[model samples]
Target: MDVDVFVAAHRQEWDRLAQLLRRGRRLSGAETDELVSLYQRTATHLSQLQSWAPDPAVVNRLTTLVARARSVVVGTRRATWRDALHYFTAGFPAACYRTRAWWVPTALVFILATAGIGAWIAGSPEVQASIGAPDELREMTRPGGGYESYYSSSPAAAFSFQVWTNNMVVAGISLTLGVFLGIPVLWVLLQNAMNVGTGVGLMAAADRLDVFLGLILPHGLLELTAVFIAAGVGLRLGWTVIDPGRLTRGAALAREGRAALGMVIGLTLILLISGLIEGLVTPSSLPTWARIGIGVAVETAFLAYVLILGRRAVRAGETGDVTAGDREDELPVAA
Candidate 1:
């Protein structure tokens, strides 16, 4: 049958389905599945009929069908852990590649660090002094030394909460700074990066390399990685304003801002998990080798999920498809 003819016949059904979805009526399992199938079918039908000779009745039916095709949803169901994982994987990487902000933060960090190094080598005491820490609270808290003083009081709990809180603050600062477009965000990004590098340099200069590695390596990898991801989101958000494509700056910002929001939320979660590890696991009584192994495993799992499994899952959803239960399947199961 002609696609128009099919649409004309089902026009009323499409409108009614749209109403059911919009109204939040509980759809039987089969009904929900059928709606999903119909949505895909109708979208295709409309695209194919676009060039065909237009009939008023068929056109009217098509417009209404298209509206319903996009509008029908079972509503926001409770997200399972599986769904949250999927959302993070899809949301972050896609946002990264889709915008220039993905590279900007890292590039900016490199540039600033190089400039700082150049200044230091040129015998700028101001630069050297500025790089110097007023206090070595971090250095003083080492495994073999008095480094434990910072968390020694509360022990594991104190370290965990401190790391977690710091991560949260950094992520929030990156996201909020996005409002200034790339400038403010870049400023915050550089500050955080510099702090990390300077802190490590201080530890190294203190001749406490083992203490540094044992203290930071376990969770610093994840914690720092999450910070960069947050920076990426901020940069992307800033790009909309700085570039804005064909749209006005405000309009472009709104568009990109909406897309980047999910990434910020996901980054928050990443920071939280990192903090948990830094506070609890990083300072654990576990052997150095064991801590390294667990840290590597956590980092590996995150990478695999984001880069590999995440993409595969999305591809499967795209081609492999989901049944979601059709109208017939929705028929009540006989008691």
Candidate 2:
């Protein structure tokens, strides 16, 4: 029970463990074995101190040393190429599939709202005037006008980067601000919907609806879907605060927040694809049908990824959260 004597005896071993840890991925086999042995012995020493001597300073030092030594002995897993492969093929798609209920309806509602507003604007001069002056609307809808020129105004590469950055910010906002009851998420989507409606109304009024569809559809399908997914995940996070069901509010938020973050990473990649299409394909000389076809193909592939791979992932019990080993340990609570 003599803390000083015990410390004197184990100090050298503790120092050795620290030295091995400092070596960091460069340990020889013998040093690795020694580190494991030292970790176990140090852990026992910590236990004894807590049980008998309980010197706070010594105990804390040993605690930290043992933890570091343990990590060195066990080693952390590096992300391999295989890990990246599995994430995209399985993890990301599974996450999307699991959230289908949220995002699918989101897409539908947004589409309906946009369609109604667009139709109203196209049909009514008053509605159109409320948006802008007649001359402004005329310029926006002209064959070589604002709506069409906006995409090609910048060089394609710069435009793609700008679009990607902007979309990422919007998605980031939807995910991060969902903690505020999702009001921001709704507002963001509504703002976007209005923009779409205004464009549709303006173009249709000028008999350029064909040009609008051809230009927009080529990238809008995938681009808009990514936005809808971001909004849905954000709203879901907000709802978790209100009704966590069996979980404590904190636990539910953590779970859904992690899933929402995963969506953020996945959506970044998805939005990049859409950005490329918007910059390159949308402004290309290719026929409207070809551009639209490319968009349709990409959108369809994404849907299939979610429906087929995602369903399989869900069936296999994937919840789109971090893998069990990476997740913090959940304490048991009585049901």
Candidate 3:
């Protein structure tokens, strides 16, 4: 089979398909039929050329044209407002619920580590000195000192935006770096836990543990939960690389990666709420109980969203993955 001869034979149909694709939504009913017919014929021609003629340039051109024609013929679904609604109401929560095994343990471990470290540092003068000089530590823990002043130093709105942006970057890093077998995610969580513990220890040594809790709890509960979720998903993704179970490594990563991305978007909103609480309520003059109560309520709502709605969505077959129609068809592989 002469490659030139094959190209001459199919060039007209390929050209016609390109024209139809260019016309796009303006295609007439008859032209639409013609476009489908030409697409099929060109696909057949491409197959024949690959088998018989094997011209690299011809194959490449046909591949691109076929892809373009297929897109036009099949019509891509554009995301709508409803899609966003579905994602939040079902997709995000379902993804979180599915990964409870990973994140729940993560939260518990982080809390315990933080508490233990804080206690050790608070009880030992040597440990406090290792962190900072007595004067510096005193300054940090003193009432109307570094810890309390830090929040009000910046204007509330500016402070909130800064907090939100920083948290977003941290969460983004956790989610994206999961492919590195979650080592980086562990480091990130550990660093965060250490910072919190240090702050608690310093405050406790100053006999200001109550002040510290009052300022931190109103925002820390939900904020830390979101971080745990991100870290847990990251670790889960890394584990998928090690043992993909029923699916191939690539497929497992793709599935978990997509879910991780969805969680990132959801966690962004969650962090925003926490940022607001930190910026507005943490530094406010409200009673400590009231402020902490508000935090508890918000945290409860989020958990209910995951356990109740997330479970329902999962049972109903939502995997927090992209819709089936949106994914490309995969070739079957035998185990």
- What lDDT tens digits, residue by residue, belong to model 1 across residues 1-335? 37656666767766655655566577789888877877665555554444344456665665576555555543334557886654555645455444434744575665468446443433443444565443543335344444444434466666677777877777777666776766776777667656555545555545565666676767866776676666766776676667878654644565556655656666667777877787677667899888878788888777665656446544555211112431111111112
Looking at model 2, how many pairs of residues clash? 0
Q: Give the TM-score comparing model 2 with the true structure, all chains together.
A: 0.78
lDDT value, residue 79 of candidate 2: 78
Native-referenced Cα lDDT, model 2? 0.86
Regions more than 4 Å wrong, model 1: 1-89, 96-148, 151-153, 246-251, 310-335
lDDT string, candidate 2, 1-335, tens digits? 78999999989988887877784358778877887888887877776776667798997898788767666555677878997777787788888887778889999999999999889989999888988887888888888799999989999999999999999998998988987899999999999999898889889888999999999998899999889888888888888889998876766898889888877778999999999999999999999999999999999999998889889988998888877656543434222
Indicate the residue-level lDDT of 307 in model 2: 88
Model 3, clash count? 0
User: Which candidate has the highest lDDT of all?
Assistant: 3
**Please, what is the TM-score per model?**
0.58, 0.78, 0.83
Clashing residue pairs, backbone N/CA/C < 3 A, model 3: none
Report the number of the highest-TM-score candidate: 3
